[model samples]
Target: MSRPILFFVIFITLLSCDKKENSVTDVQVLFEKVDSIQINYLGSPTVHDLDPLSQRVVFMEHSLSDSGHEIFIADFDGNILSSFIKDGDTRDTYGHIMAPLAIDGENSFMAYSFNGFIHYDFDGNLISRVKIVDFFNPGGRILGMGYGMEKWEGKYFYVNRGSKNADYGDKDFFDEYHTMYLLDPSTGIRESIIPFPENSLFMKGNFFFSRAWEPVFHISESKLYIVFGLEPVIYIYENQAPFNLISSIPIELPDYHYFKGSEKYNNEDVRFFGHRVTSGKISNIKYVDNYFVLSYFPGFDAADTEMSISTNTGPDFWNAMRKKYTTRIAILDSQGKVLNDFVPEGLSETSMKVKNGELWMMGKPNGEVELDYFQLFKVGLTTKGP
Candidate 1:
């Protein structure tokens, strides 16, 4: 064959091979069974916070039968450690706890928009209360909700505050914004590490935002990683403008309809669905070694009375209408190159944590949501050889 024809044939062969590799659809669960536990609260557990250092988990319990909210603590194995009510019996009316119980070993911190921030010791003793001011100016335009707490070096602790304009829907209201702050755990003094910007479009929505909601952290002692949507951007300084763009990874999905089956109405006769597609609403992102994992939940449409009602329609109709998409975990390199893709079975509430030489995740088994239980699994990654 001529040189030009030989080159063309080789190019076609390589393209064919790439298509074949991408078309394969064998999904496998990577995590091995370690242990499982069930969390029981006095009422419905709305939000939970985990302290891996102390192996402690704290959650908020609100009684649907009554109008009260209580904070409870437990070990990782679900053993009840402590429980207390912050607001006596005044009824939190908010219906749910907005913040997680921030725990640092024996010390715990809880923040409520209406009640401000409260601190507690490991034994669930009230230590101090800091009334967060300055942000929420006159007319209460700023609402500071505690998102995540991290212990930096020495007594300098960091509390991430997400702010939203109080009057969100009105024409006179401005768009919501988010900012992070560094605080002295002992003196209760906080300095604005990152100031709140007006009309910041990082991440703002009812379901999820690419830049906002996701936790930004210092991946190493020096390097910080901030995940904005599918892209993970890094910054050298804690308070640096024009963040150095690190890497952007593209999230690959099988089909658009994979997330459309979960549409339904809730008990309140309110249609709860995503106006946009689920693939667009990226839920969680975590950094593991050199790779990053992104997880998303399908969006639902408006809810009607018959949203949860099931019919005896054949298995095919049920399968077509009630189908659920497998949670996708895309492994990417530091330069944002997709390394591999895998789908784990029985994965619910999928969140990532790094420990030892493996990637740890907490999720429930398939079809176990009806039972109100969840499980944790560990997956060993083979980085040396393919």
Candidate 2:
């Protein structure tokens, strides 16, 4: 084949998986529940960050205070080491929204917020805080919820919201919106690199629905992996400067179903609620070891009472709707082939992380369990003949 033709063939393979056969026969995934750690805490807590070197995990609980958050540090044994509510000076308290925590290094972690990075030790002591604007100005539009950020190859990488004047009606809007950026705090230089994929479903037609989801992504070694909530595609990019797209992996999840929203209703309109609630979304993504770990909510399909939008609009509407969908975890290889996909009992969709080369997930609370206690476990993957 000519060089141009070979390049075109490879590009086509990256774009879609319709021509490929099922890869499950070649790879089998077996998960072994290693051990469970029961943590004792007051309110409901979600895993914010895990530090294997320090043997500590950070949990965030909703606070009634003006700052709206509290932090707890617990060891691998589930013993609460320290807990604190934001207080003292402006440097100590974060913004109203709770920023996701990233493990900085040994015995310390950092929170990336709209203002900048706040450093804290595992003992609940504040180290220092740096505002990005003071060092690197990200135009006038950097004050938004950052999805996730990490220091890779001496550069800070994070995803920020796109333009405020985004024209949703335009078919090309999603492709042009830059959502990822690289910042060198030391050099005071920043560059917006990745945008939504040009071949994304949102870029396909008049799909004007913007779920306002913060894209979940991770940088592992020399590669970057990103997966949007509204789509099932995992995009791979080079982890260096310019960050060009390497390939696109479209996943065909089992039992996944969705309903595309109508363009007439804006993102916030009530009329779009049915489509938004019924749609299947990629809830979480993480790259661990050589595999990609993903948790997703397979869209609910059931009786009228379960799916009805009108009857479900009570105070507990959101909670009730959540019970209808089952959350499943899938282990995918570096090539985006599903090795194993199954729903594990007693695991929360929001609290899974890679710890010491294994997947650790926080336990989902059953109504019978005491609210103060949290469960943690290590998932071991074994390969067998399909």
Candidate 3:
């Protein structure tokens, strides 16, 4: 498989597990009295990203029709405001936007998926598109090959895997100039590169070698915060070039099995991130309600799950692993201290976002309403992330 496809496969495949049937399965009763607004999804919707911009915004593939996947904007009362992009036969149809990077206010947002930094308004109007250069080579010659990006102020932070998945065995591919780039959107030039740490975060596989799977970060005010996909620590920086490491707060995961199983599997010479991040498979983190709330998997035990992607398929111990680990949320204080960790009922596989003291989760509503795919539950947060 190609690199980006493999990245999504690892995320949607390996991490997804069969959920448990709960006694209080009703999403409404589990949280607040507010009724949920259900939005119909097209096709087998891939809820790529979500951001609360006045109304909740979603990027998903909801129908099997020629319309492909679309960007849906909805109000808090579940009213579907509009769907962006025209219908297309294939997913790669140009006008369509897929994954989202950052949402600037309710109108403009930035994303880097199809090898460019694209900006779009909520109405799907094209704002700006900058062709990203290949940072792996000197003088930045190539056109394609860019990963995730987040914009703080006018500078956009661009990151790459530094090495290609297909170039695994090539010695020359390891000599990457940089993995992280500080890009000036106006000039279309890389201002500088944030150097990698001397140590590695790799466990036992090559999966974590790419920036594609590293800590997903957010730019809050003047501070840029980072949370690793497999690590428990939250790193803070002074949102600028040469990102100065301010603090690293360790999230206290409750489950013992969840914590132990998240560490390095063995003494093999792993890559970079394997050694850096230990468990809790952090999926999403948002600054809401003056609190930095994060959602993460409790993580499957390495010994029992045999998590090496090269060796174990995701479904092999899917049930057992999912049963063993609990999907939980860690809420951080304004000063970034661990507030509390609990599993919010009915929070499904889709992305989670908090806005105006309300927590929104996306997923299909059980078995009956499968066609109405893009499901969402808005629960009033007894807390915030701002």
TM-score of each: 0.59, 0.77, 0.61
Best by lDDT: 2
Question: Which candidate, 1 or 2, has the higher TM-score?
Answer: 2
> lDDT score, residue 124, model 3?
67
Compared to the true structure, candidate 1 yields what TM-score?
A: 0.59
Tens digits of per-residue lDDT, candidate 3, 1-386, equal 01122211111112223332221112211123143555554456444334444555445445555645466665545565667753354332234332344555666656544435566676767677676555332222111111235555677665433433344333332243344557765555666553433322432233332332345566666777776556566777788656777777776554423232222323244322343232456766766656777767665456643353334545655565556665665556666555555555455632564444456565434556446444555544453223
**Model 2 misplaced stretches (Cα beyond 4 Å):** 1-27, 66-68, 87-91, 134-148, 162-172, 183-190, 212-214, 260-265, 268-273, 301-324
Candidates' lDDT values, in order? 0.41, 0.63, 0.49
Q: Write model 1 residue lDDT over 1-386, tens digit each, in one string.
A: 00122211101111123542464233321334343345554334543455545666666655544534666777767677787666554432222233444555545655533444556665657666654455342221211112344445533334344334343323322133333455554544555544222212332222222122333443344444544332233322332333333433344432322222122322232222222223333444456655555554432323311333335435674355334443455445555444544454444434554433335455544442454534344444444222
Runs of candidate 1 exceeding 4 Å displacement: 1-29, 32-47, 63-67, 89-97, 107-113, 135-147, 154-219, 229-279, 297-327, 353-360, 365-385
Q: Who is ahead in lDDT, 1 or 2?
A: 2
After superposition on all C-alphas, the RMSD of every candidate to the true structure, in Å, is 12.2, 10.1, 10.3
Ten contiguous residues minimizing lDDT sum, candidate 1: 6-15
Q: Kindly provide the TM-score of model 2 when superposed on the true structure, using C-alpha atoms.
A: 0.77
